[model samples]
Target: MRALTHLRSLLGSILEKKGAAWPDKATIEPPKDKQFGDMACNVAMLTAGKLGMKPRDLAEVLKSELLAADPALSKVEVAGPGFLNVTFAPAFWQKTVEEVLEVKHCFGKFNLGRGRKVQVEFVSANPTGPLHIGHGRGAAVGDCVARILRAMDYEVSTEYYINDAGRQMRLLGESIWVRCLELLKKPVTYPEDWYKGEYIIDLARELLTLKGSALCDLPPAEGQDICYEYGMKSILDGIKKDLADFRVEHQVWFSEKSLVAAGAVERTLEDLKSRGLAYEDDGAAWMDTTRYGDDKNRVLRKSTGELTYFASDIAYHADKYARGFNTVVDIWGADHHGYVPRMKAAVQALGRDADDLKVILVQLVNLLRGGEQIAMSTRAGQFETLADVCAEVGVDAARFMFLSRKSDSHLDFDLDLVKQQSMDNPVYYVQYAHARICSLFAKAAERGVAMPECSPALLARLDTPEDLDLMRLMEQYPDTLANAAQTLSPHVVSFYLRELAGLLHRYYSANPVLAASDEDLMRARMLMLAAVAEVVRSGLELLGVSAPEKM
Candidate 1:
């Protein structure tokens, strides 16, 4: 990273001398092929036209200036039309080990956000039932996004929006009430449309235990209300426990009912009307979402005067912006893909840029065992709870696999694959690399050999191609984290870790660290592995997975 920073500065100074503005688009990165060089820059192609020079000519000048300005740059060549391929001296890369050791766990952190406030609201499933595997993916993606943002120095607050005040809550209550009647051996008609999960029966038993037969003696409406409150609280408590067990936590649990109780929905409608965005039509209050690109106007209040869920969502997001979040991220199910445009329209109507509202739609997880898809039905009460999956596989495996791809891509969560302790399992492979390094340290200590302090002379001994390749990959951690933050994809980190692990595994097989002919070589390799272990731990922490000391 220091190499990159220094190169950028040098190029900036050179462009300043040439009286051409430094292009923000200019980038220095690792070339795709290692044979090309350690790093490549596109400054010439980015600035050649502005300076009235050919790209190749500009590239040559850059190459000459780079070699003249930095003694660490061993080779600089103009490759192709306008690219500068750079190779650093062996000593320059050797110092990277020292840098990683010096920074330790904070090696990949960057101040990209600079304390900007960000709100990530995710896994806000209705309290009608336990979270299924689909909700698990959202939890992992949103939580890891928050973690990655924080690693980039963003002031992030996570939230779970509880859809408590809705028809679903009423149905949940009636479902429990019917179940309570059945438990008491009373005759009752169970509606086909009601929630039929076994958890509803469990809730009924809990309510009966708490209030006794007297609860059923109350009027149906009154008894349903009681069941509603009890069911909501019990289910919400279970959701909280399940999320916590999965290593996902939210700073806030915002209730939709609270928004309505505080008159925020009415206030939001008033603001929209004041902006000429809302009007009364057909005995209902409608928001002119069409003006903001929605295909049709959205109703805020129905003819019967019931506020729609969209109205409450607008109010919630209004509250979010009023709370001073520079950016608001919503993690929703992929089924809500059609809803994104309308949500963006609402945010724009609320006076925020559409870009400020980031929505990530997570696809459903296809839970599998032995390559066979498992059937899941939330309404039928025959689905795998997130807690069940975590208990069976593990929090680490579940979290990692949930983040193994883009949020919008379907994920096949094969139960048996994750439970395997082989290289085919990504989480296991990455974690094993860390454990292997730890074992090396333990072995060295048992053999009475201490890791040497990093120095140019000591690290120079690690000049093998494999040694340098490992160090080069280790040095890219900050870049990988930055890319992840920019793309809002924690899977980048997952992919990077897998590559690092694979390289480390291959390097370990080819090069013996503890059995080296010279004691100092052993010490240098130990220090390098220590830095590698630190990077692995940091990456896994960002993914909310543990770096175990042993497999």
Candidate 2:
């Protein structure tokens, strides 16, 4: 990040001297091959035509000026048509390691967000059922995104939107009541659309255990109400426990019922009506979401005097804005991708920016056992829950696998592969790199060798290609983090760790650390290894995975 800033500053100064406008910052990048240089710039290529100079000639002038501006720049060469290849002195590279030590755990953090309030609402699955594998993917992706945003300096709020006021909860109540009647050997007719999962039966048994046979004698309507309250609390509590076990946490558990009780839905409807964004249609209220790019107008309230889910959602989003968040992000399943436009329209209707509400769609997960897809256990008669997957593969492996792919792509989760301890498993590979470094420190302590103090002279002793290569990779971390945060993608971090681990493994294989013939060389290598281990620990923490000292 500092390299790019210095390059841009140089270009800005040169442009000012020539009374020309500064160019875009995006044009600067490192060369494809490390052999080319430490950094490269195309500013001369961008501004040469306006300056009435050939690109190559202009690059030569900028190269000389860059070399003269800072002693840290060892060499600046003109490459290709107009690229300025810049290499930092060995002393500069040593100072880079010192900077890493200075920040330590705070390494890779950025100020891109600058403390803007952002709310990320994800895995808000209905509280009527157990969280399945799809919800697991959403939970991992969403939580990692929130952590990365916080690292980027955003004041982030993570939330779970409980759908307690919906029809699903009512059906859940009815399902439990029917199960209760059947358990008592009473005649009962179950609805075709009601839940048939074994969990519903489990809830019914718990309800019976708590209330006894007295609940069986109440009027059907009163009995169902009792079932609804108990079932909702029990199922929601179970959901929270599952999420906690999986390391997915939420700062707030917002309830849909609370919105209705606070009259927020009604107030939002009135606000829309006053803004001329709502209308009466055949004894119902309609929102003109089409005006804001929805495919069609939507019903806000039905003719039966019931608010639609869309209306409740608008109220929920309005409440988010009332809490002073500059941005509201919703991570949803791929099936809800079509719901984005209407929600954005609702945001605008509530006097917020349409772009304030950003939605990310997570695709499906294909769970595999021994390379064959497994829908569910026929004996169990139910699909796998998030807790089940976590229990099978452990929390660290589950999270790394979930975030190993882009959110919108279908992910084939191979149980056999993730459980392996070899380098083929990315989570294992990265964790092994950290453990390798820890072992190195242990051996050093046994040999009475302490970590060398970082200084320009001491670190300059590392002049080999592998040493410089590792330095370049470590320095690229901040840029990689910024890219991931800007794109709202945490998968970049997964890819980064794997590559860094691979490089560390290769470098270790070629260089004998503890057995180096020169004591100074061993100490310098150990200090470098410490930097690598710190970075791996930091990156894994952002993804909410554990970095163990031993495999």
Candidate 3:
């Protein structure tokens, strides 16, 4: 990262000398082809038109200036008509190990956000049932994204939006009440559309034990209300426990009912009507979502005097903006893909940029066992809960596999494969790399060799290709965190750790640390490996996975 900063500043000064403005689109990154150079830049192409010179000719001028100005650059070549490919001296790369040792756990942190507030609301499933695998994926992604932003110095708050005011809650209560009647040996007509899950019977039994048969003798409406309150509280408590077990925590639990109770929903509708964004037609209130690129206007209130879900959503988001969040992120299931445009339009109607509201849609997970798909249906309640999966595999494996790919891509969570201790399991492979390094330190200490203090003279011994590769990857951590934060993707960190772990595993196998002939060389290798373990641990922490000292 320091190398990148230095290159950007040096290029800006060179452009100043040439009397040309710096181009904002210029980029400096590692070359795809290692033979080209260590780092490649396109400043020449970006600024050539302004300077009235050919790209290759401008590259030549920049190359000459670079070699004269920076002694750290070992080679500067003008390649392929416009690109500047530069390689740094070995000493420059070796200094990265010292930087890691000096900072330790703070190695990858940055001040990119400058204390901007961000709100990430995720896995806000209605409390009608337990969480299934689809919700698990959203939970992993949302929590990891929040963690990545926090590492970049963003002030982040995570929330769970409770849909407790909707018909779903009413149905949950009726389902439990019917089951309670059956438990009391009373003849009841169970609706075909009611929720069917063993958990409903369990909740009925719990309510019966607490309130006794008196609950069954009450009026149907009164019994349903009592059942609704008890069911919502019990199910929500279980959801909290399951999420905590998955290492996901929410700072706020916002209730949709609260919006209606506080008259926020009515106030929001009035605000829209004042702006001419709302109009009544056919005895119903409508929002002109078409004004902001929606295909059709959206309904805010029905003719029956009942507010639609969109009305409450508008009020909820208005409250979010009023809370001073610079950005609001919503994580939803892939089934909600069609709702994205309408929600964006609603945000625009509220006088905010559509980009200020970010939505991440997580695709479904196909649970498998030995290459066979396991069927799941949330409404029928014939599904595997998140707690079940964690109990079988583990919290670490579940979280890692949930983040193994982009949130929009479908994931096959093979239960048996994740439990294996072989290299086929990604979590095991990365954790083993850290464990192996810790073992190496233990072996060295037994033979009376303590880790050497990191110094320029000592690190000069780490000139092997393996040592430099590890250092290069470690130097890219801060950049990886920044990219993940900007793109709102935590899968980037998962991919980075796998690559870093692969390099470290190969290095561990081919090189000898304690058995080396030279004492200083052994000490140098030990220090480098220690730095690598630190980076591996840091990356795994970002993914909410554990780094064990032993497998």
Give each model a TM-score: 0.97, 0.95, 0.98
Q: For residue 34, what is the lDDT in candidate 3? A: 78
Clash count per candidate: 0, 0, 0
Q: How accurate locally is residue 290 in candidate 1, as Cα lDDT from 0 to 100?
A: 87
Model 2 worst lDDT window (10 residues): 374-383
For model 2, what is the alpha-carbon lDDT of residue 505? 99
lDDT of 1 by residue, 134-216 (tens): 99999999999999999999999999999999888999999999999999999898866899988999999999999999999
Query: Local distance difference test, per candidate?
Result: 0.93, 0.88, 0.93
lDDT of 2 by residue, 94-208 (tens): 6667778779878889799999999999999888778888889999999999999999999999999999997888887888999999899888988668888898889899999
* 146: Cα error in model 1, Å: 1.4
User: Could you give me the TM-score of model 1 versus the true structure?
Assistant: 0.97
Ranking by TM-score: 3, 1, 2
Q: Candidate 3 lDDT, tens digit per residue, 120-196?
A: 99999999999988889999999999999999999999999999997899999999999999998999988667888
In candidate 1, residue 506 scores what lDDT?
A: 98
Candidate 2: where is the Cα deviation over 4 Å?
A: 79-81, 376-381
Q: Looking at candidate 3, what is the lDDT of residue 262?
A: 100
Q: Of the pair 2 and 3, which is ahead by TM-score?
A: 3
**TM-score for candidate 3, residues paired by index:** 0.98
lDDT of 3 at 147: 94
Candidate 1 runs further than 4 Å off? none
RMSD of each: 1.4, 2.1, 1.1
